[model samples]
Target: CLTGAPGDAARNAAFLVDHSDCPAVSLAGDLSLAGLAWMFSRAAGVVSVNTGTMHLAALAGAPTVGLHGPTNPLRWGPWGRNVQSLLPHSGACAYLNLGFEYPDPPVTCLENLPVSDVLDALERMGLRERAFAGD
Candidate 1:
Protein backbone atom coordinates (compact mmCIF):
# COMPACT_ATOMS: atom_id res chain seq x y z
CA CYS A 1 0.00 0.00 0.00
CA LEU A 2 1.07 3.52 -0.75
CA THR A 3 -0.11 6.46 1.35
CA GLY A 4 0.29 10.16 0.75
CA ALA A 5 -1.35 13.49 1.40
CA PRO A 6 -4.72 14.17 -0.14
CA GLY A 7 -5.68 16.19 -3.24
CA ASP A 8 -3.45 16.48 -6.27
CA ALA A 9 -0.38 14.79 -4.84
CA ALA A 10 -2.30 11.72 -3.77
CA ARG A 11 -4.29 11.65 -6.97
CA ASN A 12 -1.08 11.79 -8.99
CA ALA A 13 0.33 8.97 -6.92
CA ALA A 14 -2.86 6.96 -7.42
CA PHE A 15 -2.59 7.49 -11.12
CA LEU A 16 0.95 6.08 -11.18
CA VAL A 17 -0.04 3.12 -9.03
CA ASP A 18 -3.00 2.46 -11.27
CA HIS A 19 -0.78 2.38 -14.34
CA SER A 20 1.98 0.27 -12.78
CA ASP A 21 1.78 -3.49 -13.10
CA CYS A 22 2.58 -3.84 -9.43
CA PRO A 23 -0.51 -4.27 -7.30
CA ALA A 24 -0.86 -1.46 -4.80
CA VAL A 25 -3.37 0.79 -3.11
CA SER A 26 -2.93 4.54 -2.89
CA LEU A 27 -4.39 5.64 0.42
CA ALA A 28 -4.96 9.30 1.04
CA GLY A 29 -4.82 10.82 4.53
CA ASP A 30 -7.77 9.01 6.00
CA LEU A 31 -6.33 6.51 8.50
CA SER A 32 -5.83 7.57 12.10
CA LEU A 33 -2.42 7.18 13.71
CA ALA A 34 -3.52 4.05 15.53
CA GLY A 35 -5.01 2.68 12.34
CA LEU A 36 -1.83 3.48 10.47
CA ALA A 37 0.22 1.72 13.13
CA TRP A 38 -1.94 -1.34 12.78
CA MET A 39 -1.58 -1.34 9.03
CA PHE A 40 2.15 -0.75 9.05
CA SER A 41 2.74 -3.45 11.62
CA ARG A 42 1.07 -5.94 9.32
CA ALA A 43 2.85 -4.93 6.12
CA ALA A 44 5.59 -7.09 4.61
CA GLY A 45 7.43 -3.95 3.65
CA VAL A 46 6.80 -0.27 3.09
CA VAL A 47 8.19 2.12 0.49
CA SER A 48 7.84 5.86 0.86
CA VAL A 49 9.37 9.19 0.02
CA ASN A 50 10.74 10.37 3.39
CA THR A 51 7.43 10.53 5.21
CA GLY A 52 6.27 9.95 8.77
CA THR A 53 4.66 6.71 7.66
CA MET A 54 8.07 5.41 6.63
CA HIS A 55 9.35 6.13 10.14
CA LEU A 56 6.28 4.53 11.67
CA ALA A 57 6.65 1.50 9.44
CA ALA A 58 10.29 1.14 10.45
CA LEU A 59 9.30 1.40 14.11
CA ALA A 60 6.73 -1.26 13.42
CA GLY A 61 9.57 -3.55 12.23
CA ALA A 62 8.36 -3.70 8.68
CA PRO A 63 11.13 -3.47 6.11
CA THR A 64 10.93 0.23 5.38
CA VAL A 65 12.50 1.97 2.42
CA GLY A 66 12.76 5.74 2.64
CA LEU A 67 13.64 7.37 -0.66
CA HIS A 68 15.40 10.64 0.08
CA GLY A 69 16.17 13.53 -2.22
CA PRO A 70 18.05 16.71 -1.25
CA THR A 71 17.49 16.10 2.47
CA ASN A 72 20.03 14.45 4.74
CA PRO A 73 19.01 10.92 5.56
CA LEU A 74 21.02 10.97 8.80
CA ARG A 75 18.70 13.68 10.09
CA TRP A 76 15.32 12.60 8.65
CA GLY A 77 15.51 8.95 7.65
CA PRO A 78 13.57 6.23 9.38
CA TRP A 79 14.76 5.00 12.77
CA GLY A 80 14.62 1.53 14.38
CA ARG A 81 14.53 -1.92 12.80
CA ASN A 82 14.19 -3.13 9.24
CA VAL A 83 14.95 0.23 7.68
CA GLN A 84 16.88 1.22 4.58
CA SER A 85 17.39 4.68 3.09
CA LEU A 86 17.99 5.32 -0.58
CA LEU A 87 19.70 8.67 -0.96
CA PRO A 88 20.92 10.37 -4.07
CA HIS A 89 24.62 11.07 -4.54
CA SER A 90 25.73 14.21 -2.69
CA GLY A 91 27.08 15.93 -5.78
CA ALA A 92 23.62 16.14 -7.30
CA CYS A 93 22.53 18.70 -4.70
CA ALA A 94 25.82 19.94 -3.28
CA TYR A 95 24.61 23.35 -2.16
CA LEU A 96 22.25 21.86 0.43
CA ASN A 97 23.77 21.62 3.88
CA LEU A 98 23.28 18.85 6.36
CA GLY A 99 20.13 19.32 8.46
CA PHE A 100 19.11 22.18 6.24
CA GLU A 101 15.55 23.35 6.00
CA TYR A 102 13.74 23.03 2.70
CA PRO A 103 16.21 24.13 0.07
CA ASP A 104 15.75 27.66 -1.21
CA PRO A 105 16.58 26.47 -4.68
CA PRO A 106 14.33 23.57 -5.52
CA VAL A 107 16.23 20.38 -6.29
CA THR A 108 15.22 17.53 -8.54
CA CYS A 109 17.74 15.04 -7.12
CA LEU A 110 15.06 12.45 -6.47
CA GLU A 111 13.73 12.77 -9.98
CA ASN A 112 17.25 12.33 -11.32
CA LEU A 113 17.79 9.09 -9.44
CA PRO A 114 17.33 6.17 -11.77
CA VAL A 115 14.71 3.49 -11.19
CA SER A 116 17.47 0.87 -11.51
CA ASP A 117 19.27 2.43 -8.57
CA VAL A 118 16.11 2.27 -6.47
CA LEU A 119 15.64 -1.38 -7.46
CA ASP A 120 19.24 -2.09 -6.54
CA ALA A 121 18.69 -0.51 -3.14
CA LEU A 122 15.59 -2.63 -2.66
CA GLU A 123 17.54 -5.69 -3.75
CA ARG A 124 20.17 -4.88 -1.14
CA MET A 125 17.35 -4.78 1.38
CA GLY A 126 16.19 -8.19 0.08
CA LEU A 127 12.93 -6.82 -1.31
CA ARG A 128 13.42 -7.20 -5.06
CA GLU A 129 12.42 -10.85 -5.39
CA ARG A 130 9.32 -10.46 -3.31
CA ALA A 131 8.31 -7.26 -5.04
CA PHE A 132 8.45 -8.81 -8.48
CA ALA A 133 7.26 -12.30 -7.61
CA GLY A 134 4.28 -12.10 -9.91
CA ASP A 135 6.22 -10.52 -12.75
Candidate 2:
Protein backbone atom coordinates (compact mmCIF):
# COMPACT_ATOMS: atom_id res chain seq x y z
CA CYS A 1 0.00 0.00 0.00
CA LEU A 2 1.23 3.42 -0.94
CA THR A 3 -0.15 6.01 1.44
CA GLY A 4 0.79 9.63 1.13
CA ALA A 5 -0.65 13.07 0.65
CA PRO A 6 -3.22 13.21 -2.05
CA GLY A 7 -3.57 15.05 -5.37
CA ASP A 8 -0.18 16.10 -6.68
CA ALA A 9 1.63 13.51 -4.55
CA ALA A 10 -0.44 10.73 -6.03
CA ARG A 11 0.11 12.14 -9.49
CA ASN A 12 3.85 12.19 -8.90
CA ALA A 13 3.80 8.53 -7.85
CA ALA A 14 1.87 7.34 -10.87
CA PHE A 15 4.91 5.63 -12.34
CA LEU A 16 5.59 3.79 -9.07
CA VAL A 17 2.08 2.38 -9.03
CA ASP A 18 2.29 1.53 -12.70
CA HIS A 19 5.52 -0.36 -12.21
CA SER A 20 4.55 -2.22 -9.05
CA ASP A 21 4.81 -5.99 -9.34
CA CYS A 22 2.82 -6.68 -6.19
CA PRO A 23 -0.56 -5.36 -5.19
CA ALA A 24 -0.32 -1.63 -4.65
CA VAL A 25 -3.10 0.57 -3.39
CA SER A 26 -3.11 4.26 -2.76
CA LEU A 27 -4.87 5.59 0.34
CA ALA A 28 -3.74 9.05 -0.52
CA GLY A 29 -6.79 11.22 -0.05
CA ASP A 30 -8.59 8.85 2.21
CA LEU A 31 -6.66 9.46 5.44
CA SER A 32 -5.52 12.42 7.47
CA LEU A 33 -1.94 12.64 8.73
CA ALA A 34 -2.89 11.25 12.13
CA GLY A 35 -4.98 8.60 10.51
CA LEU A 36 -2.11 7.69 8.27
CA ALA A 37 0.20 7.42 11.25
CA TRP A 38 -2.33 5.20 12.90
CA MET A 39 -2.37 3.04 9.80
CA PHE A 40 1.39 2.95 9.79
CA SER A 41 1.32 1.84 13.40
CA ARG A 42 -0.57 -1.27 12.37
CA ALA A 43 1.45 -2.21 9.33
CA ALA A 44 3.56 -5.35 9.25
CA GLY A 45 6.51 -3.15 8.36
CA VAL A 46 7.29 -0.03 6.35
CA VAL A 47 10.09 0.76 3.93
CA SER A 48 10.40 4.47 3.27
CA VAL A 49 13.04 6.82 2.00
CA ASN A 50 14.51 9.17 4.57
CA THR A 51 11.53 11.47 4.91
CA GLY A 52 8.92 12.77 7.32
CA THR A 53 6.84 9.63 6.93
CA MET A 54 9.79 7.52 7.95
CA HIS A 55 10.13 9.50 11.16
CA LEU A 56 6.41 9.47 11.73
CA ALA A 57 6.23 5.73 11.25
CA ALA A 58 9.15 5.22 13.58
CA LEU A 59 7.60 7.42 16.22
CA ALA A 60 4.38 5.53 15.82
CA GLY A 61 6.34 2.47 16.96
CA ALA A 62 6.14 0.54 13.74
CA PRO A 63 8.84 -1.72 12.38
CA THR A 64 10.34 0.61 9.79
CA VAL A 65 13.29 0.63 7.41
CA GLY A 66 14.79 3.97 6.49
CA LEU A 67 16.81 4.25 3.26
CA HIS A 68 19.50 6.92 3.44
CA GLY A 69 21.77 8.62 0.95
CA PRO A 70 22.97 12.22 1.31
CA THR A 71 21.33 12.49 4.70
CA ASN A 72 23.43 11.38 7.65
CA PRO A 73 21.80 8.53 9.46
CA LEU A 74 23.32 9.53 12.77
CA ARG A 75 21.99 13.05 12.45
CA TRP A 76 18.61 12.43 10.85
CA GLY A 77 17.66 8.77 11.00
CA PRO A 78 14.32 7.81 12.47
CA TRP A 79 14.48 7.04 16.20
CA GLY A 80 12.73 3.91 17.37
CA ARG A 81 13.46 0.46 18.68
CA ASN A 82 12.30 -1.24 15.49
CA VAL A 83 13.70 1.24 13.02
CA GLN A 84 16.60 -0.01 10.94
CA SER A 85 18.49 2.36 8.67
CA LEU A 86 20.39 1.53 5.48
CA LEU A 87 23.07 3.81 4.12
CA PRO A 88 24.66 3.61 0.69
CA HIS A 89 27.70 1.35 0.58
CA SER A 90 29.61 4.07 -1.19
CA GLY A 91 30.56 6.83 1.22
CA ALA A 92 30.24 9.46 -1.49
CA CYS A 93 27.07 10.83 0.09
CA ALA A 94 27.62 9.87 3.68
CA TYR A 95 27.63 12.17 6.69
CA LEU A 96 26.19 15.22 4.99
CA ASN A 97 25.83 17.62 7.89
CA LEU A 98 23.30 19.72 6.07
CA GLY A 99 22.18 17.89 2.96
CA PHE A 100 20.76 20.86 1.06
CA GLU A 101 23.57 23.19 2.14
CA TYR A 102 25.86 21.52 -0.36
CA PRO A 103 25.46 21.77 -4.10
CA ASP A 104 23.77 18.82 -5.78
CA PRO A 105 26.04 15.97 -6.88
CA PRO A 106 26.15 14.73 -10.45
CA VAL A 107 24.08 11.69 -9.57
CA THR A 108 21.74 10.57 -6.82
CA CYS A 109 23.79 8.66 -4.25
CA LEU A 110 20.77 6.59 -3.25
CA GLU A 111 21.16 4.54 -6.39
CA ASN A 112 24.38 3.22 -4.87
CA LEU A 113 22.37 1.15 -2.39
CA PRO A 114 21.15 -1.93 -4.17
CA VAL A 115 17.72 -3.54 -3.84
CA SER A 116 19.30 -6.81 -2.72
CA ASP A 117 20.86 -5.05 0.26
CA VAL A 118 17.51 -3.61 1.24
CA LEU A 119 15.98 -7.08 1.05
CA ASP A 120 18.77 -8.34 3.26
CA ALA A 121 18.16 -5.59 5.77
CA LEU A 122 14.48 -6.38 5.78
CA GLU A 123 15.28 -10.03 6.23
CA ARG A 124 17.51 -9.21 9.18
CA MET A 125 14.69 -7.20 10.68
CA GLY A 126 12.29 -10.11 10.16
CA LEU A 127 10.06 -7.95 7.99
CA ARG A 128 10.49 -9.42 4.53
CA GLU A 129 8.14 -12.32 5.06
CA ARG A 130 5.43 -10.25 6.73
CA ALA A 131 5.73 -7.22 4.51
CA PHE A 132 5.57 -9.27 1.32
CA ALA A 133 2.99 -11.69 2.61
CA GLY A 134 0.97 -13.20 -0.24
CA ASP A 135 3.07 -11.45 -2.85
Candidate 3:
Protein backbone atom coordinates (compact mmCIF):
# COMPACT_ATOMS: atom_id res chain seq x y z
CA CYS A 1 0.00 0.00 0.00
CA LEU A 2 1.75 3.17 -1.22
CA THR A 3 0.16 5.60 1.13
CA GLY A 4 1.08 9.09 0.01
CA ALA A 5 2.43 11.50 2.62
CA PRO A 6 -0.67 11.41 4.81
CA GLY A 7 -1.98 10.21 8.16
CA ASP A 8 -3.81 7.43 6.36
CA ALA A 9 -0.80 5.18 6.66
CA ALA A 10 -1.18 4.48 10.37
CA ARG A 11 -4.94 4.46 10.13
CA ASN A 12 -4.90 1.98 7.26
CA ALA A 13 -2.39 -0.19 9.06
CA ALA A 14 -4.63 -0.32 12.09
CA PHE A 15 -7.64 -1.25 10.00
CA LEU A 16 -5.71 -4.01 8.23
CA VAL A 17 -4.50 -5.45 11.50
CA ASP A 18 -7.93 -5.34 13.11
CA HIS A 19 -9.93 -6.66 10.19
CA SER A 20 -7.60 -9.32 8.73
CA ASP A 21 -5.19 -11.81 10.20
CA CYS A 22 -2.59 -11.09 7.54
CA PRO A 23 0.45 -9.26 8.85
CA ALA A 24 0.87 -5.72 7.58
CA VAL A 25 3.90 -3.49 7.18
CA SER A 26 3.71 0.25 6.98
CA LEU A 27 6.42 2.44 5.50
CA ALA A 28 6.85 6.11 6.20
CA GLY A 29 5.98 8.55 3.46
CA ASP A 30 9.54 8.94 2.18
CA LEU A 31 11.06 5.52 1.73
CA SER A 32 14.57 4.98 0.49
CA LEU A 33 15.42 2.59 -2.32
CA ALA A 34 17.57 0.56 0.07
CA GLY A 35 14.64 0.16 2.45
CA LEU A 36 12.42 -1.05 -0.35
CA ALA A 37 15.10 -3.49 -1.46
CA TRP A 38 15.31 -4.90 2.05
CA MET A 39 11.58 -5.46 2.17
CA PHE A 40 11.57 -7.15 -1.19
CA SER A 41 14.39 -9.45 -0.21
CA ARG A 42 12.36 -10.78 2.68
CA ALA A 43 9.00 -11.00 1.01
CA ALA A 44 7.66 -14.32 -0.19
CA GLY A 45 5.17 -12.82 -2.62
CA VAL A 46 4.13 -9.23 -3.20
CA VAL A 47 0.51 -8.08 -3.35
CA SER A 48 -0.26 -4.45 -3.92
CA VAL A 49 -2.57 -2.00 -5.59
CA ASN A 50 -1.74 -0.62 -9.03
CA THR A 51 0.90 1.69 -7.61
CA GLY A 52 4.60 2.33 -7.98
CA THR A 53 5.24 -0.30 -5.38
CA MET A 54 3.91 -2.85 -7.82
CA HIS A 55 6.54 -1.76 -10.30
CA LEU A 56 9.21 -1.92 -7.63
CA ALA A 57 8.14 -5.45 -6.82
CA ALA A 58 8.58 -6.42 -10.45
CA LEU A 59 12.04 -4.87 -10.49
CA ALA A 60 12.91 -6.88 -7.43
CA GLY A 61 12.09 -10.13 -9.19
CA ALA A 62 9.30 -11.04 -6.80
CA PRO A 63 6.11 -12.75 -7.87
CA THR A 64 3.69 -9.85 -7.81
CA VAL A 65 -0.08 -9.71 -8.01
CA GLY A 66 -1.64 -6.30 -8.35
CA LEU A 67 -5.27 -5.35 -7.76
CA HIS A 68 -6.98 -3.01 -10.17
CA GLY A 69 -9.94 -0.93 -9.17
CA PRO A 70 -10.68 2.41 -10.85
CA THR A 71 -8.02 1.87 -13.54
CA ASN A 72 -8.12 -0.43 -16.54
CA PRO A 73 -5.90 -3.45 -16.03
CA LEU A 74 -5.10 -3.74 -19.71
CA ARG A 75 -3.45 -0.33 -19.76
CA TRP A 76 -1.98 -0.12 -16.26
CA GLY A 77 -1.27 -3.65 -15.12
CA PRO A 78 2.37 -4.51 -14.63
CA TRP A 79 4.21 -6.04 -17.57
CA GLY A 80 6.38 -8.97 -16.55
CA ARG A 81 6.49 -12.73 -16.49
CA ASN A 82 6.31 -12.79 -12.67
CA VAL A 83 3.40 -10.45 -12.35
CA GLN A 84 -0.36 -11.03 -12.53
CA SER A 85 -3.13 -8.47 -12.34
CA LEU A 86 -6.70 -8.97 -11.19
CA LEU A 87 -9.26 -6.55 -12.48
CA PRO A 88 -12.99 -6.20 -12.17
CA HIS A 89 -15.27 -5.89 -15.16
CA SER A 90 -15.20 -2.66 -17.17
CA GLY A 91 -18.74 -1.76 -16.17
CA ALA A 92 -17.91 -2.04 -12.50
CA CYS A 93 -17.08 1.50 -11.50
CA ALA A 94 -17.79 1.44 -7.81
CA TYR A 95 -14.20 2.12 -6.88
CA LEU A 96 -14.29 5.40 -8.74
CA ASN A 97 -16.42 6.97 -6.04
CA LEU A 98 -14.28 5.87 -3.15
CA GLY A 99 -13.43 8.54 -0.51
CA PHE A 100 -16.50 10.45 -1.67
CA GLU A 101 -19.61 10.74 0.42
CA TYR A 102 -22.23 8.24 -0.65
CA PRO A 103 -25.41 6.94 0.91
CA ASP A 104 -25.96 3.23 1.44
CA PRO A 105 -23.91 2.01 -1.48
CA PRO A 106 -22.97 -1.60 -1.91
CA VAL A 107 -19.56 -2.86 -0.81
CA THR A 108 -16.49 -1.28 -2.35
CA CYS A 109 -15.27 -2.53 -5.72
CA LEU A 110 -12.47 -4.62 -4.24
CA GLU A 111 -14.73 -6.02 -1.54
CA ASN A 112 -17.00 -7.37 -4.26
CA LEU A 113 -14.18 -9.48 -5.67
CA PRO A 114 -14.81 -13.10 -4.80
CA VAL A 115 -12.14 -14.99 -2.91
CA SER A 116 -12.26 -17.79 -5.45
CA ASP A 117 -11.25 -15.36 -8.16
CA VAL A 118 -8.16 -14.24 -6.24
CA LEU A 119 -7.29 -17.79 -5.24
CA ASP A 120 -7.56 -19.04 -8.81
CA ALA A 121 -5.29 -16.28 -10.03
CA LEU A 122 -2.78 -16.97 -7.30
CA GLU A 123 -2.83 -20.66 -8.14
CA ARG A 124 -2.14 -19.93 -11.79
CA MET A 125 0.75 -17.68 -10.77
CA GLY A 126 2.23 -20.48 -8.65
CA LEU A 127 1.91 -18.41 -5.50
CA ARG A 128 -0.31 -20.93 -3.77
CA GLU A 129 0.57 -24.55 -3.28
CA ARG A 130 -1.27 -27.71 -2.26
CA ALA A 131 1.60 -29.19 -0.27
CA PHE A 132 5.33 -29.34 0.30
CA ALA A 133 7.29 -32.54 0.57
CA GLY A 134 10.52 -33.15 2.48
CA ASP A 135 13.51 -34.32 0.54
Best by lDDT: 2
Per-prediction CA RMSD (Å): 2.8, 2.3, 5.8
lDDT, candidate 1, equals 0.74
Q: After superposition, how far is residue 62 of candidate 2 from its true place, in Å?
A: 0.8
The per-model lDDT (C-alpha) reads: 0.74, 0.81, 0.65
Q: Is candidate 1 or candidate 2 better by lDDT?
A: 2
Q: Which pairs clash inside model 3? A: none
Using lDDT as the yardstick, the better of models 1 and 3 is 1
Clashes of each: 0, 0, 0
lDDT score of residue 86 within candidate 3? 83
Model 2, residue 68: distance off in Å is 0.6
**lDDT of residue 100 for candidate 2:** 64
lDDT of 1 by residue, 14-99 (tens): 68767896566666676778888888898878887776777888988888888888656777788976787777654464334455
Worst 10 residues of 3 by lDDT: 94-103
State the local distance difference test value for candidate 2.
Answer: 0.81
Model 2 Cα lDDT, one tens digit per residue, 42-115? 88788899989999999998888999887888898989988888988884775567766554554478888999
